[model samples]
Target chain A: MTDSSVPATALEVRLASRPAGWPTTDNFEIAEAPVPEPGPGQILVRNKAMSVDPYMRGRMSAAKSYVAPFEIGKPLDGGAVGEVVSSNSDDFSTGQQVLHALGWREYAAVDASQATTVADDLPSSAFLGVLGMPGMTAYVGLMDKARFQQGDTVFVSGAAGAVGSLVGQLAKLNGAERVIGSAGSAEKVRLLTERFGFDAAFNYKDAPVGEQLREAAPNGIDVYFDNVGGDHLEAAIGTMNDFGRIAACGAISQYNATEAQPGPRNMFQFVTKRLSMQGFIVNDNGHLKREFFEHVAPLVREGRLIHEETFVDGLRNAPEAFLGVLRGDNTGKMIVNV
Target chain B: MTDSSVPATALEVRLASRPAGWPTTDNFEIAEAPVPEPGPGQILVRNKAMSVDPYMRGRMSAAKSYVAPFEIGKPLDGGAVGEVVSSNSDDFSTGQQVLHALGWREYAAVDASQATTVADDLPSSAFLGVLGMPGMTAYVGLMDKARFQQGDTVFVSGAAGAVGSLVGQLAKLNGAERVIGSAGSAEKVRLLTERFGFDAAFNYKDAPVGEQLREAAPNGIDVYFDNVGGDHLEAAIGTMNDFGRIAACGAISQYNATEAQPGPRNMFQFVTKRLSMQGFIVNDNGHLKREFFEHVAPLVREGRLIHEETFVDGLRNAPEAFLGVLRGDNTGKMIVNV
Candidate 1:
């Protein structure tokens, strides 16, 4: 057979249906489309790795939010790191590696300006995890939103996940007096203290989160990096010190609930403790990108900061990778290698 | 009766028992004690007026908070304005009017350092309402805590009461683009728009707060001064614009609820909208007192800022005045004329 016998089509994952509670494989559809041509100021990328983040769950629903919902019968898009295969712009070369928001597909045609060029020294997939959206989220939420102090006691929920793991390490490196974390499993709890250098860690399933948090932080926490909402938020509020601050990045726990969950019943604790809580999206703080990279890249390059990834191979498996994120079945960043 | 037959005792209101939920007359005890004698660095004041504020409800409970709980069988203390009848310190004289945290009593023996001398131009009782804790709470909550912008659309809950009434007026005078208020009664709603110069006012008791708020502020609110929490807080969250700020000064609606009230279930709105919520107490922000008086005192003297009071005369009726505050029975500041 000749080399021309190989198919030239690209595989993509599309939204087949809106989810009712928890999304299943039925919600996603696999399809093939002709590879797109790059126009002026645009580049065609062959995606190597892509992210499946918790925030994407909110975008799946046809609800009013900061970002628009993913339309049905269209390819899903998110953080992706890939090699430029065709270029119609002077800024990007055919062989250059870049990061862009065009994932769950084998090929992407995007404006050159939307694609950020990455350093060649590290693995290209690192841009989809620790060097990309998740990294920036941890930095902005801790330094800017929470106003983390040098000696503050910090508590992080979802400590085994990508953003949460970075948040705990950053707090420790910045001289936090004590760093406490809560994870979903015992193995994740062990990884938090031993691998991430957390002062204390606990599995939330072991006991009531409020009691466990109180025990983990007997002196009370001054800052809380909230990734999981619902019970975690309630417990954090209960154990917060006076004039505490909470940086709300994500609420992975309640993202797929069919009905509205009960909120923190003891919200009055906010008043009594003079607490300040602010919710933020990393996209809003893009101005801090230069500062974030300067501070974190060195630590990462020197092996001072650790990062992990759980990869699911092939574009067809992207939907399962995303579902795994919602189920907390993977640690660190959940990505699909296309 | 002869002039010599007059008793030289001072009447005081004491907490007879801790309130289970809502406080009643039976929770207070009327007692008489000899007028206190001033010691070195102390002054004996003959209190003319005392404030019954919403925060007192929190103090009646034994739960730990920013301020100490009111002890059983002990005199209740709060904001008071009075004449310094006996002074052992050089800073004060017998006829000087002053304000101190020694209310619910006819006479108070307080350290001279704890008493703030009032300007002679305004009535003495003004120190307990417009020029005292309530007034400072409004200024700090708006300017400092909420970071109110000059042209923001402002919404104040419990808008006919002491702090909320002033919050709306200040937003107006400070060049808010639009000022909206929500009150409990139709009369109070009318007073908010007509007397307080709010652009729009709604009676929350007349309709669902969420629907009414959306109608009142079609463009959405930029800042929310939350005095009445529960439904009002929930509705404010529902109607807030992106990057909106909430100053949670009080939660009067839930103060008397026996059960833990459900919080704003749509708190995820905070994440999508990038909202910041802060809870504050005026006592922690005493440094703003000078700036507050400098900005507001002239407005009061020039008839630009209005002051209203609902007076309950005599120490014996102090319990009723406090009860009325919790029930929203009076408009503006509820004070006992001792």
Candidate 2:
């Protein structure tokens, strides 16, 4: 049985076409579909909020990647938190809030095994940003992938974004000697230093990243958490200290480029400076999820850790939110309030 | 005390001036200096052979690097094996074969503590090549830096060179499923497959490194020992499997370039493929020396590990030998036999 609030039809966004360079609204279609009925061992969810992340851009391409590409004509999916309106399984009851990976829609019919019951302790949307995938990505990329040491000086690119913001803060909290960051705008640069506690921050649009990074990290950076690749990676390589490590989390700057970007010119520094760079995907690192929540959740609950969400009001505007994220329109996490 | 066999004056090669790009013989000066008497705790040695390595090219440049630049008008020093004809300490006796770092000179007054007595079990020049620095570089780079696994496919650039040759042979010995190599000439390619036991070999000059590497390692390479950077490094990145590791040992292709060469254009593969690249200097890895020697020394003695040296006669021709090594004129370890 469906809840009285359940609508007969719901709006879901589907991939209409693959993007060659930057994706536009034309790549997506918002269509009405009947709210799905829960089969045996399934739950029907009325999604309250959903995530619109940078990584979703990769799925829009037809290329093979760590995750499968979004199929044309099918509704796209990602992280979401919603209330279970109907349940065909004993594990979930009506009115229970759960987190699942069936987003980009107003209502979802999810397998009980794929959904996890979440408490109402914090805003349900918090699970989409600070307490979820982005958070774990920040934790693993810095602590594990970069092999961050207590006395290291860190430099993070795209510093005002979800993962970059957390990486800087975590570095500061974990005894980094200094934390420097780079962002695309003056406002984001200020936010990085003033709000996120970055020791120094720069607007990458102002000057060559190499010159700016050199100015900020005169003594050189020991760890680099990379979110925006291309120039930022080259700059970081130039400014890295001997034996420095780089955690290549994402390359948002290159994701939309029509052609492959040239990498750092001074890669010889890798040999001369004895540097190490590693890349990782968050899903492959699920082993760190439990430890991540145990460590970061309480800090977040106590208001010691801060997060921001730029919410778009409707499910139809989810495509807009995603496009905005790609264009760096949002701070912290971009969310769709369905 | 001085050795009776020591001449009144010996010829030594000195750096006359730093080179802008490819160093010429004009950058060097062969000068005669008096054979010095041994001071307290010193040994007088009549040199036998000296190493001319690709890494020496870096030292000839004025730029800051892992090793100090070779000073103008000062006799250059490198790995050399010779007979200790005179000693002023209890640590050494007359006519003892020893290894020390006082190459490019026919006679040396070396500190007894700085010289090591080596066995005559193999050619003494072996101490300067296969049983010495180059061998240790290959060992640490492959086993520790690249983290080679059994059944992994390994690729080595500049496969006919000192370090690259050892890297391929070691990978084969360690149970690599396949070993691929790239060299500059058809002869060297033949040597890689026939002499070095490489599964496949290519002349990088004949075709694009990416195309040739793809043809050779269709399943993709797991480990890459990068001795030639620039195009070779770019190709390796393109052809690497998920979780591939690159040991950035050297960049001979870029050493003589006047401008900093552009690095691999496909660095996003680092993120998509979850790859790791690390660089190292042999001196900094002294902790691994004992283990490397213990593991690899027996292999050399048993004729299981093969090596070749292209020897040039006379100290005055050391400059030509150094220049030749940079031009890929040597098939193996290049040495100046004094």
Candidate 3:
């Protein structure tokens, strides 16, 4: 028998095929591979938890995007929080917890330089969600892209999702006059108003998004965080105030669409209202990492910044977790525990 | 005639009815009104020339826009160049040439503060075209809205129009790496390349805009001055480089559509390329007026900047002139010789 600290084999989830539209279990393959040894400046990590985000849907396709596509027959990589089981680098020691971008496997051999040493006070999984990419996406989209002002009325689509939930909360924390959110389900809408402190929330499926948005934000919104694009974008444009800003983040509603989705018909409002719409990727704003952590880590520790995770147990179920994320089956950050 | 220089009655074009879709001559009424005497801080001017632009289409509609809707049965207003016939303020004197926003009329009683004195070296008509709103629109759209870099590869739609024509030239003068333009007809396309010094020009009517744009800008464009939106906007988004910028100057193609026009289908490119799109009115950027005139006035005086006007004679034909502009009848600035 091997030592309790070391694993002989690691089970990994590999991309079996590039998805045509909506991904299914057949697109992924579970494989057993020999645990890799740490090379020079590398550390062997026993992953505790990993993230499953909507952005992974884009990487599953061969199309060019902000990040490189996940190659078929290769283990998928994403945000992972793990404990160092062995180290070949002087910067890290065994038992230290680190966050790295080498997930979907029980164990990962990652470069020590690439792995960030996270604080031990909060759950290590928090580094994969609220204190990680999802959190940073919210911060950058609101502060930098949307240029959130102190008293601006803000609207956020996909308010139940990881990034959107954080965006509505962050806008409130930053002193927004009113925060409105749109979600797919009634429960998610309730969670937005009751848990995330949104001023108003609505189920987009209940009525036409344009009518609901107008009712919720009667005065018009100064800022809009777009996560579910299509109709939400059209509605946002309809009620945008003069000089309003829109941060185009994700478009999950259109991700699985086989045909080209129709764009906002009222785009002329952009000129009439002098509005600005900008699209950004969090990877392009890495300079804000230190600032994001400094501002958010404290709020997270004090429980002022709430976070929730719907964890699917085991690395073998990582593919299912990702599929769940795309289907909006999981609330907050969808995660997989190894 | 009482006096050739001072007519007893001013012939004016009034908005008889708000246009529903495409406007016709019936939408306007030619009326004769007594020439007004100048009040305090005002001047009575004999208009020599007036402008008819695409933006006027929006004003013709009752819809709220950057500017107030033109009231029915009231004389319409736009850029005009004239000689002051009478003055009640020290800012202007009789027989002095000035530029003001009181067009669609043979004579106007305008506030002296509203009129700007122009040099007599250039034709009075030049003020309504090259040295006026169109010129300022191109400058601000390129420099301020698009945030054009010195070496940016620029793409301009409606390249034969007043704003688009100047945008292509200004981009070249401002040190653009390459400038491409798209126009409706072969003659206008040729004019863009041969006269306006565009690196390449295409007749959008000749082929699919996406395919033409791809061939013209193989390496992708850094900045897009969008005068004609819809298909042009879609094509521009397809071939835009990383961090490309689009200045939404006008959407002339969609301006008269009876129903909601389809927006660019490839807007997802905005996120993938980290692009920014902003819409603005020249009035919002009044702060840039001094800077713009300082830089461009000398260019105009030295003939370093070129301009063209397709003048339709008489106040009675002003409605036809405007209709011609909507039909892409004019090659450059469509003007009315009053």
Error of 3 at A95 (Å): 1.3
Better by DockQ, candidate 3 or 2 = 2
- Tens digits of per-residue lDDT for model 2 on A1-338? 66888889999999999999999999999999999888999999999999999999999999999999999999999999999999999999999999999999999999999999886998899899988788999999999999999999999998899888888988888899999999888999989988999999999999999999999988999999999989999999988899999999999999999987878898999999999999999988988898889888887889878787889999999999999999999999888999
- Per-residue lDDT tens digits of candidate 2, residues B154-254? 99999999888899999999999999999999999999999999999999999899999999999999999999899999999999999999999999999
> Which model is ahead, 1 or 2, in terms of TM-score?
2
Candidate 3 chain A, run of 10 with poorest lDDT? A1-10
List model 1 lDDT by residue over B1-338, tens digit each.
11232248979999999988888999999999887767889988888889999899999999888899999999999999988887888898888889999999988989999998999999877788788888899999999999999999999999899998999999999999999999888889899888989999999889999999999999999999999888898899989999999998989888989998988787877788999999999999978988999999988899888878899999899999999988888888888898
* Residue A223 C-alpha lDDT in model 3: 99
Candidate order (TM-score): 2, 3, 1
Q: Which candidate comes out best when scored by lDDT?
A: 2
- Candidate 3: stretches off by over 4 Å: A1-4, B1-5
lDDT of 1 by residue, A289-328 (tens): 9999999998889988888899899988889889988888
Off by over 4 Å in 1: A1-7, B1-7
For candidate 2, give the lDDT.
0.92
lDDT for every model?
Answer: 0.90, 0.92, 0.90
Determine the TM-score of chain B of model 3.
Answer: 0.97
lDDT of 3: 0.90
Candidate 2 CAPRI assessment class: high
* Maximum-TM-score candidate: 2
